[model samples]
Structures are given as structure tokens and as C-alpha cells.
Target: MENGTMPSYFYFTLFKDFVHMRYLILILTLTVYLAILLFNVIILFVVFKERSLHEPMYIRISCLSVNDLYGSAGFFPRLMVDLLFDTNTISRTACFVQIFTIYTFAVWEYTILTLMAYDRYVAICNPLKYHKIMNSKVTALYMALASLYAVFSMGLAIFFSARLPLCGTDIARLHCSNWSVVRLSCGNSTLNNNIIGFFVSATTVFLPAFFILYTYVRILIICQKISKEFRGKALQTCIPHIISFVNYSIASFCDIALSRYDSDKFKFVALFFSVGFLVIPPFLNPLIYGLNLPEIRKNIACLFQRSKVGHFPK
Candidate 1:
């Protein structure tokens, strides 16, 4: 070997260690994300295959499952690949696309959650009008509007973010989120931040939170006027929605906090919570609703029995 140069074996060992860590993180993330994805798919299948689950609440739950599946698939797989292969570099165009896709999925998720809250409000607080209010036409309109809003809002955010010239090397985070990319721009990002922040907060966070809260409050008032047995059932139906609201609140706050923070430690914590908040609720939502509502559980059991029988026979 040369006198001033290190041996090839030393470089090999260093590279091996880095590769080992990357592989470990990739495996862990893949396993977790796959489990979540599989559970969501199972919920979707069970809902669609079972004719009894064609009600408004279950339809909204199916929509939420679909949204969660797309949201996780959009970001987590690319993130895992980047982490595992040491392909930390992303082209400007790819980064903008990633940011746009992630934001679009996020907006859809919030809108669906709000729609679910409205569904519950109608079912519990105005049972007589539930069918008329959440009929096929209204459901279709809501879904179409939610899809359009997601695309439009994300397009605007991405357009503004992409217009800025990026000159920095340190992005600090694993994914190219809106604020992280904006913060790295060469020019002033104040205008972009203000516009994106206002829209995001108004549409995704504040509006949804307000509706969820308002719906639940109305449900509570209706429950009070009903018989004790009906009141108990109403409260039970609300438990899952309340849990989801809390999860959304935490995640929304964490998202905003991560955008505002410069500390790597806090950012990492916020990222972890954000991912947890997104993944756990979707998986848990079906389980919670199924256990509390006997019809869903019966349908799921029937589905499993049919699967087993089909596999066993000729």
C-alpha cells in the first residue's frame, strides 16, 4: 500500500458497516409498512365483498382505508429505497413530484376524515334524515370534491415550491416535504410559507377539526334527548371517531411544529409521531368499529369462513 493512503480493506470495512445499517433500517421500515398496508387491504376487501357493509358509515370507512393505503404507499416505499440503497440524492423534479404526491394524499385523508365525521353526525343526530343526507349522489359529490381539492391544493404548493431556486446541500430530513424543501431555497421563502401555511391550516387542519368537534357536540346533544339505551349506543358509536380526532389533532400539530423547528432532535421526534399518527389510526379504525358494531364482525367472520371453505374443497 502507499505510505499516505489507507488500505482497501479498511475502506471495505467502513462501507460494509454503513451498508449493514442501511439494510437493517430498510428491513424494519418495510416490515412495519407492509403490515399496515396489508391490514388496510384486508379491511377494504372485507368491506367490499360483504354486501351488508354497504351502508354510509362503512362506505366512509372504506374510503379512509383506500386513502391510507395510497398515502403510505406514496411515500414510505421510496423512503425505504433511499435509506437502504444510500441513494440519498433526489433530482429537483423528483423532489417536487414527491412533495406534491405526499401533500395530495394528506389532503385527501383529512377531507375523508371530515366526511366520516359528517356521516356519523347524520346517523346519530338525525337518524330520520340520515338516508336522505348521505345518499349516493351526495356521497359521490363529496368524494369528487375531495379528490379535486387534493390535486388543486397540492399543485399550487408544488408550483410555488418548485419556482424557488435551490442552492443548499443540507436538507436534514429523509423526505422532501414542503417546508423542508422551501427552507433550502436560495431566495426568500416567506411568501411561499405564508401562502402554503394558510391554505394547509384552513383546509386540512382547522376546518376538519372544527367539523369533527361540532359534529360530536351535536351528537352528544341528541344522545341526551334519547332513551338511556339509545344514548349508550350513540356514545359507543362515537368512541372511534373521538379517538381519530385526537390522533389527527396530534399529527396536525406535529406537522406544523416540524415545519417551524430547526432542531434535528425535535424534528425527528415530530417525524416519528407524524408517521405513527398516520399509520396507527387507519389500522385501528376498522378494528374499533368492527368490534363495537356486531354486523361488521359477523361479516368478517363469514368472509374468513368462506375463504377457508373455498381453499379446502375441490
Candidate 2:
């Protein structure tokens, strides 16, 4: 080293390594997230435009897709920016807002999946009364209730998490999460952590998973008595919900575990699962529902063709 200068080789080597991997991760995240966003937008448009997709199942699917869109959109973009710039600083207010939005959408997603399970249970367990039971009014009420519950629960979680007075500004992760942020507080966080942990596990993990499993068991029992055609259709209808539920459950556990621990190894594992859960389900959802369902597939193809021709070519 010359004249108080640092070692060039060390700094340069680290910089090179970081630049290489950072670019790769950034590109990959952008491509995956943007592709999913584009597909989701297409699905939303198709559902809005096609009168045929106004049924209860598609309605629920649409809501779930929208939640996925918002959920991933909340955190991924910020992560991408931080990765590229090596800047992880976020304002306290911004952090709280992010926590609120992410938590709300996450809870909403779990609630939606639970409702979908109930939807399937009704459609399969009582085919004759499915229409009468899942009428628009009842469905609307369920949606409204789910939305309200998610908002209040997430609000309470945020309130408790935010109350811990900050001793310092250091955060370990790319973005502010309730757990990471709460660790910085000067006040006792045991109660806050317990409350958040309980609510998150109960609603997102236990309740939804239980309902899904119960519904599927009922579905299987019902399938044994129905015709082959009906059984096959019923199984297909439940497949997407099963996939979403499993993804959510795994991700929820990984996140809760990550929040509980401060180890770098655990954080890395948790990050992988968190991103996987967020991205995989959203990408899989359209393929599961749209590709398998004839109406949605046709509408998507038609929509693409019409877009290419530019509105009847004047």
C-alpha cells in the first residue's frame, strides 16, 4: 500500500465478484417478476372482458392472482433496487408502510385461499346446492369479511411491531420486515413477537392448511361416489388450490423461522424460500387455471391476436 491507500487487489477482487453475481440476480428477478406481472395483467384483463369467466371459481382465482401481483410487487422491486445499488437504507415511515402493505396482502392471500377451499368443498360435497350456497351475495360477503379481517389483523401487527422504540438504524436484510425491524427497538418485543407470530401462524398456516386438507379429504370421499367424469373435473378444480396452499405454507414457515433467528445461514435459507414462495405460486397460478381451462386459454389467445392486429387496422 502507498500513501495510506488500501490494497487495490482486495477491493477490486471483491468488487468484481459482487458485480458479477449482483447483475445476475437482478436480471433474473426482473425477468421472472415482470413475466409473471405481464401474465397476471393478461389474466385480469381476460376476466374483466369475458363474460363467461364471471363464475365463482374464476372470480376467486382472479382475486388470488391480484393479491399475488400486489404481494410480490410490494417487495421485489425494492429488493432489486437494493441489490443493484448496494443501498439497503429505507426510511422508518417507508418501512412501516411496506410492512403494512406486504402483511395485508399476504393475509388477504391466505384468506382467499381458505375461501377457495370452502368454495371447492361446497361445489364438490353438495353439487345440487352449490349455486344456492355460493350465490353472488354470499361470495361478496365472504370477500368483504376476509378483506376486513386481513386489514385489522395486519394493522394490529404493524402497530405492535412499530411501537418498539428504535435504538439504531441498522437493518440486516434487503428490505424492512416486521421481525428484522422489531429487533432494533429499545422496548420489550416479546409480546409483539408473540402476537405477530401467533396471528401469522394461525391464519396463514394452520387455518388455511386445515381447511384445504379437510376439503380435499371430503373431495376424495365424494369422488368415490361420483361418476368418473365428475371426479376428474373435481380433481382438476382442486389442483390449483392445493399447489397455492402448499407454497404458502412452506413460505410462511420459512419466514417465521427466519424472523425468529438472526443467523446468516438461516437468513439465506429463508430468503430463498420466501422468494420461491412469492414467485412460484404467482407464475404457476395462471398456468394451472388458464392453461387447463378452455375458456381462459381461448380468450388469452384471442386477446393476443387482437393486440397484434391493432384494433381492426383502421
Clashing pairs for model 1 are none
lDDT of 2 by residue, 1-314 (tens): 11221111111112223454778878988998888898888788888788988998888889988998998888788778767886546666778787787777777878888889999999999889999999888999998987887878777877876666555555545555677666665646446577775876587557877877888898899899999998898888787778778877777666666667754555445456545556777777777778877778898988878889886212
What TM-score would each prediction reach against the true structure? Answer: 0.86, 0.86
Model 1 lDDT on a 0 to 1 scale: 0.70
How many angstroms is residue 42 displaced in model 2 relative to the true structure, after the best TM-score fit?
1.2
What shift in Å separates residue 155 of candidate 2 from its native position after superposition?
0.8
Candidate 1 C-alpha error for residue 65, in Å: 0.6
Error of 1 at 92 (Å): 1.7
Candidate 1 lDDT over 1-314, as tens digits, reads: 11221111111111223455677767877887887777777778877877778887888878887877777776688778777667766666666676777677777777877888898888887889999999978998988987887788778777776666555545555556777766656645547666785876698768878888898889888888899998887777778767766876677577677667764556446446545645566557666766666777777777678788785212
Q: Each candidate: what lDDT?
A: 0.70, 0.74
Angstrom error of the Cα, residue 241, model 1: value is: 2.0
Off by over 4 Å in 1: 1-20, 265-271, 309-314
Candidate 2 lDDT score at position 62: 91
